[model samples]
Target: MGALGAGIAALGAGIGVGMIGSKATESIARQPEASGDIRTAMIITAALIEGAALFAIVVGLLSNG
Candidate 1:
């Protein structure tokens, strides 16, 4: 069960990161002048999503331990 939970967390994180990358690329394409700002925001959002996923995986581990 813990392994399953961890896998789900990772899958969610990967999807979130992929979406962020795709959107960031589209935004940059549409507004090349603001690519710098878009990239910074994308990085921050991806980092936050990763942190939440990390917390969830940790909880799953502790629960099964």
Candidate 2:
């Protein structure tokens, strides 16, 4: 169950990051001048999502232990 929980967290994070990247790319295409800002925001958001996923995975493993 712990492993399953961790897997789900990873999957969710992957999806979230992918969506962020996709939207960011679209925004950059629409506004070439704001590409820098869009890319920066995308990276920060993706990092946050990854951090949360890591925390969740740790909790899940600890619970099992």
Candidate 3:
């Protein structure tokens, strides 16, 4: 069960990061001049999502043991 939860958390994070990247790419395409800003925001948001996901996965695994 814990492993299942961890897998779900990782999956959710992957989807979230993918969506963020997709939108960032679209935004940059629409405004090449703001590409730097869009890329920065995307990286920051992805990092945050990853951090939360990591925390959740750790907790889930620990709960199993």
Best by TM-score: 3
Candidate 2 differs from the real structure by a C-alpha RMSD in angstroms, to one decimal, of 0.6
Any idea what lDDT model 1 has?
0.95
Question: Which runs in model 3 stand beyond 4 Å of their true positions?
Answer: none
Per-residue lDDT tens digits of candidate 1, residues 21-51?
Answer: 9999999999999999999999999999999
In model 1, the Cα lDDT at residue 28 comes to 98
Sorted on lDDT, highest at the top, how do the candidates line up?
A: 3, 1, 2
> What would the per-residue lDDT of candidate 3 be over residues 1-65, giving only the tens digit for each residue?
99999999999999999999999999999999999899999999999999999999999999997
Candidate 2 lDDT, 20-42, residue by residue in tens = 99999999999999999999999
In TM-score terms, candidate 2 sits at 0.95
TM-score of each model, in listed order? 0.95, 0.95, 0.97
Model 3 CA lDDT for position 46: 99
Query: Which of candidates 2 and 3 is the stronger one according to lDDT?
Result: 3
Q: Which TM-score value belongs to model 3? A: 0.97
Question: Poorest 10 consecutive residues of model 1 by lDDT?
Answer: 56-65
Q: Model 1 segments beyond 4 Å from truth?
A: none
